[model samples]
Target: MDVTQFFKAPSGPASMKRKMAAEPSDAALKRLRNDEDNDNDEFNGDEDDDRFMHGDGLTEAHRNLLDIVDSAEEAPATIDLPTLKRYVLKLEKSITRNEEMRVRYPDDPLKFIDSEADLDEDLHNLMGVSAAPELYPNLVSLGTVSSLMALLEHPNADIAIATIQVLSELTDEDVVAEASEEGEEGMKALVADLMGHQILDVLVQSFSRLDEFKDGTDDKQGVFNILSVVENLISVDPTIAEKVVSSTTLLTWLLSRIGMKQFDSNRQYASELLAILLQTSRENRLKLANLGGITSLLKAISIYRKRDPKEADEVEMMENFFDALCLALAEPEVKTTFLEEEGVELMIIVLRERKLSRMRALKVLTHSMTGEGGAACSNRFIDALGLKTLFPIFMHKGLKAYKKAYKSHSDSEEDEHVLSILASLFKTSTPENRLRLCIKFSENEFEKVERLLELHEQYQARVHAADMQFERDRIAREEAGGYDGDEEVDAADMRYLNRLDKGLFTLQLVDLVAGYLCTQASEDLVREHMAFLLNRKGKDFDLFIKVLEEYAENTGDATSETNSERALILTVVEKLQIISSS
Candidate 1:
């Protein structure tokens, strides 16, 4: 039997499926019968006599089947300590034999191919150890982790790929979830050992060696599996994200891979891993910025600026890139890099073009233009004629048209992001740019203020419904032998969280933008228009003050920046109160 056939790698998204041992083939059965006949000719010749003496019982084949079943029944259901140690030893031996064979026959595939096959089978068999992650420390102590990492540099790409598959399985999140507290400690130890062996460097180096396009499906699966391994490690130990970026070229490889125009599982996986890494580690974000990650990501996503992705995976890849960009923009320096790379301009074009990327571009813009770091991005956005593109969406006319044209458009999400961008503009713009923003609301017959009021009412109604539900639930809980002190505090916390989820957060943003315009609009025309609209709804500046005060209180005192922003909101509240009294 050809052992290599059993080791064929699976294609598409990286997943772990253990390869079951194959049944014996007809040819192997014939050979086994011939050997038995030659070794025991007396028994073969006396087959009839033997059957009669055995009381018409089993033939040799039946007896063999019975023996197999008996052994299977006696086999342990799960791999235990002794079995794991033996498996590790077998894996190490396979690795050593394959290495030796390759060294002895550097130019001869026939000489080393069997060893390579054996090694592949061994690697896959090791995946069974993942089911028993509580034994990971045992597996590590057996010293096969280092051996597996070494195989990443094996001469044959298939061997390296198989090794990655094994590693991915061992470090998978499912294993993490299944592990007990002791098993978790074992997993941590195993991860530390893998890292100590420079798994990140080895994995990145394997990327250069395995050419997915040139080497066919197995090589492609290899790249995907390598990504899975790294992602799994990070999931197990979030600090690994920083370690990966700082210690290896994995981040650089991810940036390059995602930039490739060819859309494939690996590219999609690369985008996802990049987003995960960026979201997890501030140091990784800075590393990405210094490596021109912002520009690379923009260029990668710019393809969808005009044309939407044709496949669901391609669309997911686009969203991942946008998510990574937004996370990266959270870093102050990355925002600068984004502006320098014409990111603001790209987003404006995406918004105007009204492609599938429009909503994500809006979200990216909101991130780029937020906080003190966003001052430059916000100013640049206005300079790039962003207002012309944004105000149309903010007004909902363009958004309505977009939703009609595209089935997937999200009105509330788009509205939330657009309002967030406006709020950021109000917060971060300079005196000159601030006036430019306030002027937009004043123009168009106070149309922007009208829209703000419309959104305020919409979100306020949603929040009000949620608040009513909260009250009912609280009263019910109180009537049914209510919570003790801790439970009461938890219930209160849940109430606020429930409110936030049911549009309270968006409502706060709407009120914030409205309050900013009321106090700081370039002309009194915008403020009066807002006041008129508020009175029309039986609301006034006092209502705005009340919401803004609640919003400010929730801003917390965790950071000085939070305190400062809280103070700024309170100041806006004070100004609104004064105007309301007058």
Candidate 2:
């Protein structure tokens, strides 16, 4: 997409192109003349104009077929399959008629699919034999799943492959959803049957292009479309994962696909699908682990770890893959071995996406840390400064303070959910690691440090209690001759000791100095933080004075109280000093 061009706001008024693009779907021209296809092939149009949709152009056949499909849909699943088939046959002729549409309206089909109604259509049903079984019962029959599977090899490879790819979407989702809803083992078996027969070579062939081919855009696009079908199919029918493990050849092929560079367009989506496939491998998960699949996924994340980091497609793809991997790793089953595999720094990355990815990362981390995975995690956490690395993430909200955080809370029913998770982790987790997590998240980054301290205190009691339990267990275990190694710490049990020792001192100072960094942020972030810090009636003058002295030294160009911020600091300093001196 022309990202900038599409995102650009209306000029003094709307432009002709903008007006045409935004016209109501009912009014928009779904069909356009195709100049490219000598046979006047009409491509399906998707209304994906960026304002509403991603705005990739579709063609005539896709458009007309969709219109026919839409015109046929009832409230939900009530499509008249027999009539629909007849309509589709006619729709094919319409596409043949509009073969010339591609020339004049190369992008019209993309626009049509972007329309709300068209976009909302159940895509799986569109391609599945069940949706139109009366017309092609044999192709879509329960027994015919294998028959449909055969199309994957028909002489016209494109038609056959596309049909099978679409079939993957159709049956699997219904079967899987059915299984989940009613505990139907039969549904699972049915899904296994259809997918088990998959043409393994075709699946790999779909990904083999890898964007290296020099000619034939049509063929290349067909491959891309097939890949898209694969994405939808795997997403809906993850249970079909059994098929992945059936053949040693298929398993190795997918593993190799997962190991491929994420930057390869043809392979990128497939790599992500492979991750999903791994997660769905109910009994085969252990096999996946032994094959280094988790490491392969981490390597996928590494591919996205940019050095200079311009915000681009790679960044976006990396973000998507990052979330998928974390989500996969976080699942109860997957988390078992994932945490033990040198993933602490990777966990920190999840907890620190610097955007919404942070929450997603945290969700997965919390899941892993709360289950059996937590045992392995706690043992490994302190070795890597585990929770310490994520502490800053809990404390961040740009240069702005809890004002933004609070604003967010007001709008979202979701709390600053991380606090509770950390508290829970602190209570259930080993005391040493809990304390380190406290010291870590408690740093003062951009705005205020007090929030960090407050979160620290909220968890302190639970952490202390947990630490006590951990200490007693340690002592008893030790007396029993259970000492694991010299690496273990002596309890030096001071039950009263805060353990606000040397390492945490840096953490506390980071919390305090992080307030100053807020001023360095863009003014909006600074103003937001100021609004939060200045909300209370009380003050801390000595701390404010110290902050002012440091700000003056760091800024060199400071004119002091003439700046509103400095004046506010001086005001806070006077009040705090009085409160302190008293």
Candidate 3:
């Protein structure tokens, strides 16, 4: 029967017709949604009162009818086929109003589906049809789904497209749930079936529509409907993604849709859906090595990334797009394709200088190293000093990102690069494996430190010279009988003294000074910096405390003083439970 015929028919499932004499009538639906019901605390409400009142929503007449039906219910009510079909139509039409209607008829949908005897066997047969390939050789089920997919090919294009959209949105949850319930073996079967059949047909037909599609309106509804269908089908059945991507022919169609020259709404959605398809199947990773896919996609993203840097959604889209594209390094074939097409230089350029693209590159690199071939290729690139250029960025706080965070205080917390690099490092455990990762970053950093030390000594002598001048001036001023107020010390000298003498404020300068001693081991630089920054500036007693008690506890000093610093350090270590008991 035509779909319209089935809708108008008087016979359907067994449970739908089985309303008892005491069942609540349609008016009860209005009672279910009324404000009084919501306030009554049991969570029942008038579904009609929903904020978005639509023409297709539950009308007062339908609620009264449901109230009449509910009032008639009694135990073991026998609903006839005729009455069941009527209720089925009512339920189907009321679906658009579902967010509200489900609340009103809470027991009906569950009871209607749960009982095997109550449901139409044909409707239930739609469950995971793709799981058994022999079952739906035509790519559409015989009853419910067949009727739905057929709607896409209907002559009334608007009606067909709308039907496809509604059907996809409406049935997607149930289809996915059914596939999930079957588990992996069933899922693989379902994916393979869709990959071989329905997926190709949809792409071909959708692409064909582009020729006739108009800019203003002829294309919109159909394009959106097509994408919605595409999204629904692949979202739950990712196995088809590889099939769509690996076919060089399908790849060309996708490229033509949203690559550099095309940026319309349909193309935009196509790009978005393409991402979803690859992401779900992880086929996107493969596409990075696919001829024309990566280069074209990145070219598109470079433009978008630059054009809408401030638009958070665009940034997120760019992120997902590249991340999936970068998964190319996984297969040796794909890796070769990548360097051959774009080369190792592209990876470094993206990492070193491309604004947001660097993050996407890191993400892809992380995935690439996840696979054996990718790990080896990435090692070669790094041995060439790619990582050396990037590692310095992680050492300095708040220096990694040039873009401001849309979220608060996240900028102060930690570097994204540090987290990214650490994640990449954790993949391997052996030192022979990890040593190449060190990038000799500390060597150059240490050389810079030695240079800084010479400057530090020069600075110390200048400060001491100023102190001597102050002493000379003080004696001369007093000798003159009355010291002129103009005997004020230079601003620079006073600033230096304040920094040297202050407490917590001096810690900032101490950290700068102690950082020069970074070549020491076991996080010794951080330890020394923390302690040295804490030491009192220019006080001989405090200096003795630092040298004898904290700095060189292994060496006994020639000058004798009480070792309060050592006691304090030991106390702190004990409280923290860092050292073990004998």
Candidate 4:
């Protein structure tokens, strides 16, 4: 039996089939081949005759058939809207009918397989809705969504798989954003309905049934299909993604699935989904961390840490693992988990020994150390004795060489991140750790401080040029009558302030190191480095004064750092003045 003939609305005259089977006229052949519009006069058939209408002629039994046939001729033919609504009704009815058949033939399981397969094919045909997602409004109103989601938990796995296939078709990624409507109402309405009906729970339930240990063909396809549907939903709306992570066992399952060591697409997809979920929510990250996710992630990537994966997807999977670990480490609670799992040791091993995951490890470490809530992580670094390894990498000529090779400031972002990490580490340091940091940099004739000064000069020049350019541009805009308002000026000013402040943070870090050496180190060490610190170009003195003044204005005399740092700055000022006088 022809499958296309199985499901369609009735069309055309009954006698017309015989006429169509007969040898068509030369005119009919020409029209059928190219759909060319030839004048009616070219054919000798009378206009008033019923047959001349070519099956569209008005008849007592079916006058509307002609209009329906005309509409069906449009390209990429779909069942008409009314017929589609009726088709949805049939799909809803088939679900109940299939359940009844399963009950009736309880002993003969194969009896319902063919019916389930046919129903699957019917659902697959619904892909035509992509071109006309507007049709989704009516289908959703008819409770087709509820019926389809119910099948995801059917006793027969085949029925569940078929439902997944249909859901994937409805929410395909490529068509979600391209739905042509006023504000994409079609796709938005479809997703809203899916989410509102808790499709996440249904989809996750389907995913939970698949066993990766079984190499069965159906099981593998089902896993792939379910992942695709979940990806599509999350890609369309982030709220759905949050719901997916919070509402299901998916995060825990993905944590296990990625460590399967199979090197298959399923493992690769699991890695990707885990990264997306962790990045989507801090709660998701914390949840995964609580489930021993950080350990699982480290174990999976440990294989490829020493060398690259052979396949592109495997490499991507590993990178996703890296990304996920980075996001998880941002949470303070997860940082505790990291300590328990010996995560610092793992990252240090990657940095010190592994070439394949070296850059990625640096990024994870940087994210772990830098930022507002990383004081505890910074303390962990000290307790782990990470400085023994970190200082060598920072002072290596290779880092400076890499910084010099890039011309664009943006290209040096990783280098800046490294600097930020160091600054953050020092920001939360105790007196003992600060002295230890000073001793580490003073090795090899103070090369680290010299490098820090060089980097500070470079960023200072960039910041100065940026500030000058902004002023010039602001003047130009005002001269051309292009000053929009205070909002635009204020926004631009805020951006400039951020750039200036970032530049100053690095410079201030250098000042901090110099201040520590002056206050905490022996007098001989401060004297030895005094000229190098005071004599650089790029307004180092002005920046030092600016930082000092900001601290004074923002903090009171009661602040411990303010009082201590003020005394250190004054002492450094006297040394610089004495050097200038000499």
Per-residue lDDT of candidate 2, residues 436-549 (tens digit): 544443245432245644533343444456566767876887798865444353343233233332122222233233332233223344334433554462433243346445
Candidate 4 structure quality by residue, lDDT tens digits, 448-493:
7676667656766776777777778768877887756776878676
Q: Candidate 4 — which pairs collide? A: none
Model 1 ranges with Cα > 4 A deviation: 1-76, 96-112, 215-217, 558-562
Clash statistics: count for each candidate: 0, 44, 35, 0
At residue 580, give the lDDT of candidate 2. 44
Off by over 4 Å in 3: 1-144, 174-203, 210-213, 242-251, 261-268, 279-288, 304-310, 352-354, 375-388, 397-440, 443-582
Give the TM-score ranking, best first: 1, 4, 3, 2
Tens-place lDDT per residue, model 1, 94-126, is 888977887898776778778877887777778
Angstrom error at residue 77, model 1: 3.2
lDDT value for candidate 4? 0.65
- Over all chains combined, what TM-score does candidate 2 have? 0.45
User: Which runs of model 4 end up more than 4 angstroms from their true locations?
Assistant: 1-87, 93-114, 133-135, 172-176, 179-189, 212-218, 235-242, 280-282, 370-373, 396-411, 461-481, 490-539, 544-582
Candidate 1 has an lDDT of 0.83
Q: What lDDT, from 0 to 1, does candidate 3 have?
A: 0.44
For candidate 2, give the lDDT of residue 305. Answer: 32
Compare the candidates by lDDT and give the number of the best one: 1
The digit string of per-residue lDDT tens for model 3 on 342-406 reads 54555566656635555556566555554445555455456556656555544442343554532
For this target, which candidate reaches the highest TM-score against the unseen true structure? Answer: 1
